[model samples]
Target: MKNIVILFALIGLLVSCSDEFLEKEPFGELTDGQVELPENIESLVISAYSILNGQGNEASNAFNSPASNWSFGDVLSDDAYKGGGGTGDQNQIHRMEIYNIDGQIIDVVQKWSVLYEGVYRANTVLKALKNTTDFDEATKTQRVAEMRFLRGHFYFELKKLYNRISYTDEDGNYLSNTQITPEEIWTKIEEDFNAAIAVLPETQADPGRPTKYAAWAYLSKTYLYQGKWQLASDAADEVISKGGYSLTPNFSEIFIPENDNGEEVVFAIQYSINDGSPSNYNGSIGDRLMPPGGPRYPAYGFLRPSQNLVNAYKTDVDGMPILGNVDLTETDNVDPRLDVTIGRPGIPYKDLGINYEESWARDLATYGPYGPKKRVISANHPDYLPSWPYVTAANYSIIRYADVLLWKAEAEIELGNLEEGRTYINMVRERAKTGCYIQNLEGTANAANYMIDTYNDPFDSKEEATIALRTERRLEMAHEGHRFFDLVRWGIAADVINTYLEKEKIARGFLTGATFVAGKHEYMPIPQSQIDAGGKDESGNPLTTQNPGY
Candidate 1:
C-alpha cells in the first residue's frame, strides 16, 4: 500500500487538469512532511482513475469525441449510410463524396491532443511509482502492475488511433521522437500488458481497481492488432478458460445500476456519486444524443442512430438473423441486435407505448426513436436537484468477454486453424440469433436456449473467414469505438471508407458528395500548437512537412 502512496505522489505531480487547474497548483506545493505514506495512497490511485475517466464525458456524450468523429470517416467511406451536411456546411460529412474534407482534419487533431494528455497522466503515475521510496516491496509490486496496465492501455489507444506512435520514457521524455513502426509499438504494448497480467490480482477487493483478468483481456486485444493470431487467441481463451470470468445471463443486467460490480464485469471504471465528487465525464451521453425535447421522460438524448447501422439487424428467419442483401430503404424486418443497439422510429417502445412514425424524423414533433435506450441518468430531471450534480449510472467496460471471444476466433483463423476459429465465431453468432435462426426464434432465453450448431458456416478460404470475423466485430462492437481501428488493421481504410461514401451518395441522393481518400488524410495531423511549442513529433515528421498535406 506504501506503493500506493508513491503512486499518489506521482499522480499529484503529473496528473493536473487543463491549464487553469495547473496554474492553481493544488498538488505541487505539498511537502514530504504532509504526504501520508499509506493512508493517502488510495486517494492517489483514485486520482488516476479520475483522470482516465475524464474524457468519457466529452467522448461518449458530446459525440465530438475524436474516435467517434473519425468513425464518421468510416461510415462516410462505406456503403452503409450518409448524413445531410454538404461541403463546408453542417453536413460536411455528407460532402465526403464531393471530396470536401477539412473539418474531419480538425477533429483528428483535437482527438490526438486530448488522447496525448491522457497518456501523459498515465506515464506520470508510472514514473512516480518507479522512484517512490515510501512503499514496501509487495505493495510496490502491485502498484507497478497497475501503472503498467494503465500505460499499456493508453498505448493501445494510441496504437488504435495513429497505428504508430513514439514511446515515452519514465520521466515523460520521448525515447524516440521518430515514429516507431506499429509492430515496434506493439512490442512495448505487449510487454506492458504481460507485466500487468503477472502482477495484477485476479479480483480486486475495491470496485474500480484492475485485476488479472482485465490485464489478460487487454493483452488479448493488443495481440489481435499485432496479428499475433495465436497469441491473441490464446490470451482471450485464457480469460475464459482460466480467468474465472463469465457472461452475465441477461445483457440488460450488465448495464443496470444495481448490477454494477457484478461477477460478469472483469473491469469497469466505477462511478459513484458518493465517492469523492461526481465526474461530469461520467454524465449521461445517451441522453445528450437525443433530439432536443425528444423525451424528457427518458432523459437528454441527442445522437440519432444512422439508418445504415440500424439496417444491419435482420429479421429472425428460423430463429437466426439472416443477413438481408436489401437496399437501405427496407426496415420492416431487422435483427434484434439493432433494437438492442440503436433506437429507431416505429419500433414499439415498451416504456413509452408509442411507435415512431417517420423513420427520419428526429425533431421536436417526432421524439427520437426509442430502441437503444440511453443508460445514463439526466441531471435536468426533476429527481435530480441542482445541488446534486446530475450523473449517469455508467460503468464503462474497458474489456468484455464478448470481445475476447471474437479475438480468439480471429486468432484461430489466422493460424490456419479454421475449425477452431469457426467455434468461436459461431459461439457469438449463436447468441445473437444471426444467420440460420431456425434453432432459436423465441429470443426469450439466453445462450442456453439457442442451438447454434445446426448451421455451420465454414470458411472457403482464410481470407473469407477473416472477413466474416471482422464483420462480426463491426456488428458486435459498433458505437463502442472499435470500428475505425478495425478498418485500419485490415488495411481497408481507403477501400472500405470510400465505398461507404459512394453508397451514401447513391442511397441518400447526395452523389457528387465528399470522398474519404486514404494516406492523404488518414490519421490526424500533429496538433499545430504542439508543433509550435516544440512538442516531440509522434509521427516522425522532419518538423518541416505538416503530415503530407494540411
Candidate 2:
C-alpha cells in the first residue's frame, strides 16, 4: 500500500511548479534530497497531471495553446469558422482555417511546445520513480502506469497534429533525432496504453485519473485512427463489455458543470475555481469562445459553427439527415441535438431565460449568427467564478462513452459487420432522442421543432453504412473538436472540406478564395521555431523534416 497522507503533503507544491517543467533542464543531475523520498516522487507525478490542462504557458496566448482542439479540429474543417471581429482577428488561426498556414505561426509553435512540455513532465515522473527506493512496489507500478498513460495521450495528440515528431522520455536525450516512423510512433502509443491497462485499477478514487477502461477506450481510438480494424474492434469491445460506462440519459447534462465526470465520462480534464489562485489554469478554452455582449457574461466569439454544420441538423420526418441538401429552413424538421449543441437565435441561451439573438454575435457578416452552447456556464451556477467573465470551472470531457460507441461502430462497419455497426450507431441516436431538445422557460413548448429517430432498418450496404456513420458522428460530436481529424483519418478531408468551402463561400463572403490543399493540409507543418532549435541530425542533415509543401 501507498502512503496517502504523505502524498497529500506535496500536492500543492507539485501544482505550483508544473509550468517549470518546460524550462527545467532534464539532464541536470538531481541531488538525493530533490526526489529520493516517496512523497517527493509522488509530487512529480502530480505535476505531470497538472499540465494536462495546457495552461500557464507564457510563450503563447490562451487561445493558441487551448486544451480544446477547436482551432485545427473544428474551424479548419467544415464544422466551423474562425469567428471573431473579422478575418484579421487571430489571423494565424484564420490563415489555418483557409489553408494558408506556415511553419512560423505562434499557434502552431505554442501547441507544439505545450504538448512536448507535457511529455517532459510525464518523463520527469517516470524518471523520479525509477530512482526512488523508498516507494512501495505496488504504488510505484501504479504511478508508472499513470505517467505512461499521460505520456501516450500527449504523444497521440502530437502524432495526429504533426505526423512526423521526435520521441523523448526521461532516459532519452532531449530533442534527439530518433527517426521513428509514423507506424513506430503508433506502436509506442499503443504500448503505453497497454502498459497502463495492465497495471491500472478498474476504478479510481479521483474521477480525473485514468482507469483501466480509459486506457482501453484510448487504445481503441488509436487503432481506429490507424485503420487497424480488428484491433480497434477488440479494444472497443473490451470497453463495451467490461468497462461499466453508459450513455448519460440526457445529452445536455453531459456538458453541464454539475454532471461532469458522470457515468458517461470515460476521462476528463479536472478544473477548479476559487482556490485562492490568480491563474485561470482551471478555466477551459470554451469559455473564451462564448458569444459577446449578451445579457449574460461577455465573451470572445471564436470557433463559430459553420452554416453547413447548422444545416446538417435538418432531418426528415423519420429522423434521417437530408443528405446532399444544404438549404435548411427554420420550420424544417431537424435533429433535437441542434439546440443542445448550439445557441441559435430566439432560443434560451441556458437557464438564464434570455433568448439568444443576432446581437449576441460579434459580427454576423464576418462569421455567422451562431454561438457554441456546450462550454458556456450559467451565471447562476454554484461554481461560477468568472475571472474577467471568460473563465469557468467546467471540466472538459476528453473521452466519453458515446465516443467509444461511435469508434466501435466505425470499426465494425470497416470489418464488414454492417448490421452490427448499425446497432451501435442507433444506440447513440436513441440516447440522443430524449431530453435533447431545449424548451422555453415555461417548459410548455420546444424552442424549435426538434425531431430525431433511430435507424429502424439494417444498413443496405457497406457504402451506405459508412455514410451514415460519418453523418452521425458529425451531428453527434459537432463542435466538440473531432471533425477535421475524422476527415483526415478517413482520407476524405480534401473532398469534404473543399466542397464545404465552395458552398459556404456563397453565404459567408470571407471564405471566397479559401481552399484546402491535399497532402499538405492533412497535417500541420512543424513549427519553424522547433526546426530552428533542433532540426539537424548528427551529419548536419535536416532531422525534423517539414511536412510536404510547407
Top-TM-score structure, candidate number: 2
lDDT leader: 2
lDDT of candidate model 1 versus the reference: 0.53
Q: Write the per-residue lDDT of candidate 1 for residues 363-453, one digit (tens) a residue.
A: 3222223323424323343322223234454555666677788888888888998888888877766655533221122333321122222
TM-scores for candidates 1 onward, in order: 0.77, 0.94
lDDT of 2 at 206: 73
Which segments of model 2 are wrong by more than 4 Å? 1-24, 27-32, 56-60, 173-178, 285-287
User: Please, what is the whole-model Cα lDDT of each candidate in the order they appear?
Assistant: 0.53, 0.80
TM-score of 1: 0.77
User: On residues 260-366, what C-alpha lDDT tens digit does candidate 2 reach at each position?
Assistant: 77888898887766554445444563346554447776757887878888899998887788888467787888888888787788888878878888788878878
Q: Model 2 — TM-score against the truth?
A: 0.94
